[model samples]
Target: MSMPRSIGSGPAPRHGSIARSSFSASYLSQSPIAQESIARDLAEYSDDEIEQPESDSEESGSEDESDASTVRPNAPQHSMASSYRRPSFVAFGGTRPAITPHGAEGTFLTKKEKKQARDEERSLLRDNHLAPPKHPEPSRRNTLSRIYKKVFSTKTPKTESDLEDPPEALFSAEPSESSTLLSNGPPESKRSRREREDREWEAAVASGKIKTTWQREAKTLMTNASPLVITFVLQYSLTVASIFTVGHLGTLELGAVSLASMTANISGYAIYQGLATSLDTLCAQAYGSGRKHLVGLQFQRMVYFLWALTIPIGIFWLLAEKILELIVPERESARLAGLYLRILLLGAPGYSAFEAGKRFMQAQGLFSSCTYVLLIAAPLNAFMNWLFVWQFKWGFVGAPIAVAITDTLLPILLFLYVRFVDGRQCWNGFTKKAFRNWGPMIRLALPGLLMVEAEFLAFEILTLASSYISTTHLAAQSVLGTVTALTFQIPFPISIAASTRVANLIGATLSGAAKTSAKVAFIVACGVGLFNVALLFFLRSYIPRLFTTDPEVIRLVSTVLPICAAFQLFDALAANCNGLLRGLGYQEFGGWVNLFCYYVVAMPISLGTAFGLGWQLEGLWTGPAIALGLVAAAEGWFLTTANWEKAVEDARERNSNG
Candidate 1:
């Protein structure tokens, strides 16, 4: 054994003298895995063992030699004592040790013996130890080979316990099949990787090895929702554009159009939208369960049911003048609002039919045609409003007429698309079975309608209450409401997408996926809400100027807009959760939640804070904010923790019974 001079300054150990060896820092630094292994081995050898070199024991060495002689009886010269000596740690400048045969000592060796001794010492040093070999180590280069093997080799994990992947990476682009995939196999494209991940995910879920990641679920929801959101913005702009066009007519026309729009929203539009959601559940489940054609029939049934319900609604609109006279202060404005209402009433059936068609298309994942149809209808609606109201000089009546024509055109467009181009597999040309399912349609629709109606009526009540305070406050509230409505379009599409996706997954008996969809929907809605808050916070002072430059109205709007901005998060979450309920077929429960949160909790707070506490418009806005918070909290908790297995069963039953 040999040691370096003072580890740096002293002479090397004389040959045949005991010495210790330490690895070079440069060698250890070259390979982290080697360094780690060496460090671990060093730790295993305690301080007392490494620091204290044992003295030569003649008794033990003699006994080992005697045992070796007994084993090799004919060769008593084969002494184990020779093998008991510590190896040398010679640097490049130091003399190498001589290899001696058994019982040979105090003598120099031949060239072959010295070479063998040097090789043995090198092997021991490569292992960072000076002890003699226990059995035998392979060549020193083998250690380096192992390190390189670890560095470059890609091996599939043998067991679930061996897998250290994060949830995000569970669906990552890695090839887990084999290490030889790159060399001995075909090249894997991105699409193939994604498909492999999909198969793996389904297997994992089935075996309960892993649940779907919320991030992956959100990505799925966003992938499905993005185009739908664009479509919604385009479709909703039809109404906004109508308002913009009519605003150029006169202040009276502006107020009349605003009132008529709000009335139509609460009375007819919201109900129709809610009722159409029934198809979201039925169609999505049917499509997912592989009964694709049933979705089309369900869409037809929804349209028929909604159109029949619109008859009495039209009669109610015919008496809109008298109804407006009771609530509205000005008789002339009331008379004009009535006329606007009657014209808008002609679009009610069309609106309902469009909603049904939209949900049907969305359920089957045929979003492109719906978007293309709305893409044309939205701009056409705007053009007609411009032509009929401004160019034609038809004034207030022309706005409603243009809106009616646009609304009527949507269903015809969607119907033509389904009949001639898309959804032919599901359409089957309308069936008698659809007419017979009136009872089931009503059962499913009423709860959804009530759920939407409760929330809609709550806002409408606030609008009506604002009118009592002052017409100026009413107008300011309307401007703020419009801004909120536009921002709301962001989450509205997310809810619809989430609902459809969840229902689809549930129908396929993928309960875990359904739950993931709900979770992702809630999370994305919150993110969008935060964005809305930031956007509106920056624009609060300037947004009012878009609708009007009147300082008084602007000042009032500026005061209330911040409060509205603050509620955007809760509003987004609550709205998306409601969508979750619709997809889970818990529309009845959602109706109760809205009824309690808005009517019982929010309405009183609003009326009391505004009139009793004299906070006025801000107070009125504050109540809805509080209600939205409560609803978001309640619904978020339920959706996050609800029994997704039961949701799947319920979806199956709903589709089965229908």
Candidate 2:
């Protein structure tokens, strides 16, 4: 005759929710293991120090002390003769074991009694007649110190010296008998989302440079300069072929080729470079962190993923004439530009894929592949241009066909090389994990894409704006633009190398090295820009002859060459700033910088100066010069002022849980 457990005042249903049944059975044994353990621990404590068990439970959850005290538990000894009754700590009737409880004064609180005491304490606090207690609030300084000790105490590896001793040793390769992964996670995956976050946070906490430098800034500048040199060579080659072949066909064919080449390279530069370079950032970081598998997976996914993005680009290629008609108002120029753009576009996706694959290799410190790939394709592109235009008598259309074939071929060749050569050689480094996760790809690409679009739009608008000027002015603008494009490659490669190094040093938490690298890159770019300025001034006459020999066009172009010469310093600053920002995952900031430079300040002032100030075409180009120069100086100084240690500390704080 034990009293049954109560379920409210109503009769209980035979069948109910599964949870209700479990609850009914669980209430029978209220002395859970946690409660028992607490009781056992309290056995060693003095009677006055032992806390009430119910109060401990309530405090754990923090909101139910009153409810806990209302429990009408059936006593263990009084069970033989019991009746359902209102709860009272002191019993009135029944069992002899309940007659005299002698040791009760020892003060070991039962769960129910402790809960009652807690409820009384709270009630007293709420009582209107009782005065409020005066207590000082917890200071953040003390709390933070405790937290710091907890995080960075004996277990925290603070210095290179601290890491010498191993902490709570982990199995070298997991337990052999029942081996858990000796690796971090899935065999294909090198680093989990959580793992990367944790390590980055830890590195940041150490106040280490995520990007560092020393003598390498000069190297970074040299690296950036190579492409500029190459660009100049390519422009020379293009001009030689166009004049040699299409020059005999009259101004229409010559102009057509001009429109086509301009459209093709401009599109290729942005679309292909944007996607491919973003991959380089990812691959570089992965390489730095020793995530061998991610490099390959990233490469593979990019190949397939690029195919998707290429569809729209491909469509533009296919419909180049239609697009030209819409964008270009002069009917003849529009038709000619459209025809050339369409042919060039046929080879868009292939060229784009080539760019992406090459960037992956570049990130691995394999820039030679780019040179090798260029060796096979660039000369072939030139030869094909001559053959199709002069050798086959296809005219302007032949140049586009030639570009298309070569553009597609380069990517195919690179993809094959990566698959057969790098594929088997570095299986571990080419993990399939990156292909599986879309997160990294998206994070890297979005910002770069924004930059590419903004930059491309700015130039396209310039072209449109230039069209508003006289024909001679338009020609000068184009000549200056083309020269700048060709020569700017000098600093680009250095920027590329700096980007990879910054990412690597940043990841390693080598703050000093990262700073050195940025400075080195800046100094190198400045030197290269200075040399380029002097060289352009000395060879001003020969430079215009490279594109065309039309006396008037050449004269206007020569006049503007000096203006182009003046912007190299600005180019160095802006390009390297872009590198620094991209390396430090400040892509969004770069985008904002571009927005301000291109639209907010530069475009309006330059446009106003060109048209409003009666400066005309030369004045329009001057707009971006001033804007880019100012932005470069500001961004470079900002990079200088940044607290690398604090940045790392913030990153580490975010990643502690992992």
Candidate 3:
């Protein structure tokens, strides 16, 4: 099973905010998966292997043999040092060297005499061309090679032995003791090895050989979060590229593209992402249960489901021009925005597939796959915008075309990676099972959809509400939203890192360590919140100018900046709280909290303050700030009282049932 299964089995809970970050860079640096990988590698070395002294063991062969006999029945029967030696290193290739009669009969010898006997024995072997070759080949095919062959190779095995062994065997080397034993018996399976390692880890943790501390957790969180920050920034740049390229055309083009993107996000992209989140639970549980093929099955199910929903999405985009004209007063801008969405429809399936694929990879603990994909896609997207918009002189239409192409390219690249490089083991080819399991996936998907859509629509409502006040207020809203979203990119990734870390601890049944991780997450969140608050407060006057040159928009943004800054701590805390909930498998609770806070509380206050009280943009900001505080407070309280032990039980139940 992949490392992510340890986190929990729920719809991969996404925190709802105006502009949520979707990048999951869970494999880099000191991420839980990376740490787990390190632990797995270290498991190969036994304590004796690491600490045993060669000189002491060599001087006391009888004692060493007795110790080996105690460890394993076969241990004293095989001496790896005596059985295997490099043929090229031995002297006297074809002659038998003389040996002492007492040494041959195993009489005790002094250290000098023993060395001389060993040298003579080696010379005899070398003389007879009998010295062992290095790196003896295994007798049977490795597990991965067998799986790959069964899945991809057309030739069928004629017998059981044919499946067990490779087509050709190289016998140019002498076998080590372990290899010799393996040749005599069946090779250990990966599942058995993993189970053994897990038992070892649990034993160590239970015995207090492993301990969690603030400094260690803090360092792990930071190390994991740093790469995610870069990944999120790069992915967000995909949207920014369109804005930057189109802005040069004129204000109208810029506004139209912005409007189009917002429309597409709410109407199309968000739905795909929300639905795809169900895989977080389904795939994770399946993987944890050692049914790896279910990861691909869950992925296929989400992709098909998202694709099915695209019919309505396509119809909406097709008529978006008329729809936008009814609500937006600027006909030309609305027309251009509708045109953009219509063109963007071409890439919707690809975008949906990419979202599902991201979750599939995440379930396999291949977090850096998407990051690596974006590293190429993001820069290529920018160049596409420039090439199509200016170089090819397609003007307004060129931007959407560029975006569509980039979106389509994303899943293709991910597919190539899965097909050839990694993540293939989880896929056992397409099956009809994907078409059967619709009920459970949809059940898990709906709450995630509502949670994401509610918060997304609430923020979009604020933007729409600003339009009613005046175009100047609307422009200021854009600048303010961008500033807040930029700051959000940092804390959101930190929350993801925390969520996975806590989840891993819980899965391991380490409630005490999980709590320690939660505390570290909260402290880190507070620090990040304060840093963002200070940044916005100190630079409020200048930050707006970077987005716009208009004096009115600048002044409005600067005046309202402090209000946004005030909630920075709340926003950060709320994000982390939601993450902790996800780790605890109570993400549904966070969804309900966000849905209620943003709509039931935040909306009315924002609308009433802006319209009823006539405080304008500042009044509009009032509602979300209060909502963020409530979200942070409510989720924080839930986490404090949460049953982490119960969460561990739930994870175990899910894995067992799967």
Best by the lDDT measure: 3
* Error in Å for residue 64 of model 2: 57
Report every candidate's CA lDDT.
0.56, 0.47, 0.60
Identify the leading candidate in terms of TM-score.
3
Task: Summarize candidate 2's per-residue lDDT along 410-498 as a digit string, tens digits.
Answer: 77776667676653322334333434555446555554454444444555456556656644454455556555654554554455456
Summarize candidate 3's per-residue lDDT along 349-425 as a digit string, tens digits. 98888878876776555666777788888899889999999999999899899888987998999999998888887
Give every collision pair in model 1: 1-88, 5-10
User: Candidate 3 — which residues are off by over 4 angstroms?
Assistant: 1-210, 247-251, 281-305, 390-395, 426-444, 637-658
lDDT of 1 by residue, 376-451 (tens): 8878988998898778888778888988887788789988897788667656565566666466566655655654
Model 2 misses residue 653 by how many Å? Answer: 5.5
- Select the stronger candidate by lDDT from 2 and 3: 3
State the lDDT at 214 in candidate 1: 57
Give the Cα-based TM-score of candidate 2 against the true structure.
0.57
